[model samples]
Target: MSKLDSLLAIPVLDRSNQPRIQAAVDGKAKPPRALGRIEELAVQLAVIQKKSLPSVRQPQLLVFAGDHGLTRSGVAAFPSGVTVSMVDTLLAGRASANAFARVVGARVSVIDAGVAADLSDRRGLIHAKIAMGTQDASKAPAMSTDQVISGLLAGADIATQAIGDGADLICLGEMGIGNSSSAALVIHRLAPAPLEICVGPGAGHSPEGLAHKHMVLAKAAARTDAAEPLEVLTQFGGYEIAMMAGALLASAKAGVAVVVDGVICSAAALIALRLAPQALDYCIFAHASVEPGHRVIMEALEAKPLLDLDMRVGEGTGTLLAIPLLQAACALLSDVADLKDVLEAAS
Candidate 1:
C-alpha cells in the first residue's frame, strides 16, 4: 500500500480513556471549565495517548523550505533568494521559529524539500531536495506525480525521525517565496469559496501586488479540475506544503498531536484531512492567521484556533505560542491531584 493508504488505514484517535481523563480534570482544585479551550486540549492529548494523564513532551517543529515556480508569475513581493537566506537564519538559530521553539523547549529542523538554490551543509538542515523547485503552475502542474510522492515520503520520514527521537507532538511550518499563492489555489480546489476570498497579501504585498497575486493564483488554479486532494496538491502545492501534509498524516499515525500553523499550514492540513478524515482528531489549529482566507479554511474544517495574535508571519510562530497552552492543559491532567486530596488537605 502507498504511504497515504497506510495513513488512511489508521483509525481515529482512541477515546476509551475520555471519562477517566475528564474525571481527573474535575478532581482538580479549580472549578469546572475554568481553563476554557485548554481543557479540551488536555482531553485531546489523553485521547490520542489512550491515557487519563497526558503530557506533550519534546515537541518537534519541522520547517520545510522550497521554491515555487509560481513566483515567476509575479505573485509574491519578495524574490526567491529569501527562501535560501531564511534557511540560513533558521540554521543560525535566528529565525522566528527558532526563537519560539527555544521558548517552548522544542527542537527545530529545517528541510530543503525543493529550494531552487544550493545551501551549504548546515547542521540542522535536513537535505530532502526533490528537485530544484516546482514547475510554474500557471503553465503546468506545480509538481509531477513522482515529485509529489517523493515530497510526501520525505515529510513522513522526518516525522519518523522525530518519533524515533521521542517527540510527543509535532508542528508544521514552511518557507517558500510564492507558497502563499500555492496555498490559495490549493484551498480553491478543496473548499468552494469566492476567488477573491481565497487570495491574501503574503509577506507584505501592496494593493497592486495583491491584485496581481489574485490574478496569478486564479489562473494557476484554473489549470485543473482535479478535486481529489492529491491531484489538487500536485496541481498547485509547493514541495514544502505537500511534504507538510505528509508529515501531518505520519504524525497522526504515530498518535502524536500536530500543532498546525497559519494559512499555509492549514492548507496542508486540509489536504491531509481529505486523505484521512480521522487525522483531524489528532490536530490542533495553532491560531487564526492574519490572512483573511484562513478563517474560511478553519470554518470548512470546523477547527477553532488556540490564539488570535493577528499573526500571519508563518514559519510555525503560532504553533510555538500554543505549546504553553498544551503544556498547561497537560499540567492540569498530570500535576493537579484528585478531589480526595483537596478534601484531605482541608480536613
Candidate 2:
C-alpha cells in the first residue's frame, strides 16, 4: 500500500479515555469548565493521545508554500511572485507567524510544496516541490494523479518527521498567493455547498476584480468531481493544500494534535476530513477566516475555532497565535493541583 493508504488504514481515533480526561479537567482546582476553550483543547488532546495530561510541549508549525496557476487568470490581486517572496520572508523568521511562534515556544518549518520560483538555494526550506506549480485549474486539472500522490506523501513525511522528532502537536500553514481562489473551489466541492457561497475577494479584489474572481472560480468549481477526494484534488486543490491534507492525516494517524488555520487550511482540512473522518479527532480549528467559504467548511467539521479575529494573513499566523491556547490548556490541567489533592494537603 502507498504511504497515504497505510496511514489511513490505521484504526479510527482511540477516544477510549474520553471520560477520564473530562473528569481530570473537572477535578482541577478550577471550577468545572472554568478554562473554557482552553479546557476544550486540553480535553480533546487527552482523548487523541488516550491519556490525561497530554502535553503540547514540542509544538511545530509546518508551513507549506506553493503557487497557483489561477492567479494568472486574474483571480487575485497579488502577483504569484509574492508567494516566493513571502516564503523567503517566512524563512527569515520575520513573518507574523515567527513572532507568534516565538511567543508559543514552537518551531517553524517551511515546505516548498510547489512554489513557481526556485527556492532551492534558500537555506532551511524543505524541498518537497512536486512541480514548479500546478496547472491552471481554469484551463486544466489543478494537479496530476502522480503529483497528487507525491504531494500527499511529501506532507505525510513532514508530519511523520515531526512526530518522530518528538513534536507533540503540529500546525498547518501556507503561502501560495492565488491559493485562496483554489481553496474556495475546494470548499465549494467538499462542502458540497452552493458555489457562490464559497467565492470571496482574494487579497482585497476591486469590484471588477472580485467579479472576475467569481467568474473564474465559479467555472473552476464546476469542473470538480466533488464526491471523490482525489478527484476533487485534481479538479481544484493546490499543492500546498494537498500537502496539508496529508499532514492532517499523518498527524491524526500518529495521534498528534493538528492545529488548522483559516479558510485555505480549512479547505485542506475538509479534504482530509473526507479522506479520514476521524482526522477531526486530532484537529483543532485555529480561527474562522473572513473568507465566506471558511464558515461552510468549519461548519462541516463542526469545529469551534479558537479565535475569530478578522485575520486572513494565512501564513499559519492564526495557528501560531492559537498555540499558546493549547499550551495554557495543558498547563491548566497538568500544573494546577487537583481539588482533592489541594484539600487533602491543606488538612
Candidate 3:
C-alpha cells in the first residue's frame, strides 16, 4: 500500500484506558473538576500516552514553510517574497516563534515544504520541498494528487523522526504568503460552508484588498467541487498545510499529542481529521485565530480551542503559549497528590 494509505490505515487511538485516566484525574486532590479543562487535557494526554501519569518532557515544535501562488492574483496584502524572509528568520532563531519556543522550552525545527525560492543551502532547515510553492488555484489545481501524497509522506517522515528522537508532543506551525487564502479554500470545500463565510481578512487587508481577495478565492473555490479531503487539498492546499496534515497523522499514529496553531494549521487539521476522524483524539486545538473563517473550521471539527487570543501571527505562537498549559495538565495528573493521600496526611 502507499504511504498515505498506510498512515490512513493505522489503528485509531486505543481508549481502553480512558476510564482509568479520567478516574486518575478525578482522584487528584483538587476539588472534582475544579481544574476545568486542564483536567480534561490531563486525561487526554494520559489516554493518548496510555499512562495514568503522562508528561510532556520532550516537546518539539515544527514550523513548516511554503509559498502559495494565489498571491499572484493580489489575494494577499503582503508580497509572496515575505515567505522566504520569514523562513530565514525562523532558521536564524530570530522570529517570534523562536522567541516563544525558547520561553516554552520547545526545540524548534523549520521545514522547507514548498517555498517558492531556492533555500537548499540553509543550515538546520529540513529539506522536503514538494515544489517551489503551489500553482495559482484560481486558474487551475494548486498541485497534483501525487504531489499531495509526496508532501504527506515527507511530512509524516519529519514527525516520525521527531517522535523517534523523543518528542512526546508536537506543535504545528506554518509560514507561507497567501497561505491563509489557500487555507480558506480548503476549509470552504471541506467544511462545506459558504465561500463568503470562509473568507476573512488575512494579514490586515484594506477594504478593497479584502474584497479583491475574497473574489479571487471565490473564483478558486468555484473551479472545483472536491469534497474529499485529499482531493480538496490537492486543489487548494499549500505544501506547508499538506505537510502539517501529514505530520498530524503521523503524530496520531505514534500516540503523540499535537498542538495545532492558528487558522492555517486548523485547515491542516481539518484535512487530517477528515482522513482519519480519530486523529482528533490526539489534537489539541491551541487557540482561535483572529481569522473569522477559523470558527467555521473549528465548528466542523467540533473543537473548542484552549485560548481565544485575538492573535493573527501564525508560526505556532499560539502553540507555544499552549504548551505551558499542557505541561500544567500533565503535572496535575502526575504530581498532584490523591485526595485520600492528602486527607490522610492532614489527619
Q: Give the winner by TM-score.
A: 3
Number of the top candidate by lDDT? Answer: 3
Model 1 lDDT tens row, 1-347 = 86657756767677878888787777787878887788888888988978777888898899999999998889989999999899899999999999989888999988999999876467768999999889999999989988898888789889878988999889998888988888888887897577688889989899999989988877877777878988988888989998998899889888888999999999999998988898999999999998977988998999999899999988898999999999999898888777788889899
Give residue 139's lDDT in candidate 3 (0 to 100). 95
Local accuracy by lDDT, each model? 0.87, 0.87, 0.92
Question: What TM-score does candidate 1 get on C-alpha atoms?
Answer: 0.97
Range of the 10 consecutive residues with the lowest summed lDDT in candidate 3: 2-11
Clashing pairs in 3: none
**What's model 2's TM-score?**
0.96
Q: Return the candidate ranking by lDDT, descending.
A: 3, 1, 2
TM-score of each: 0.97, 0.96, 0.98
Better of 1 and 2 by TM-score: 1
lDDT of 2 by residue, 293-341 (tens): 8999978777888899998888899998888788788787689889999
Question: Model 2, stretches more than 4 Å misplaced?
Answer: 224-226, 341-347
TM-score of model 3 (CA atoms)? 0.98
Better of 1 and 3 by TM-score: 3
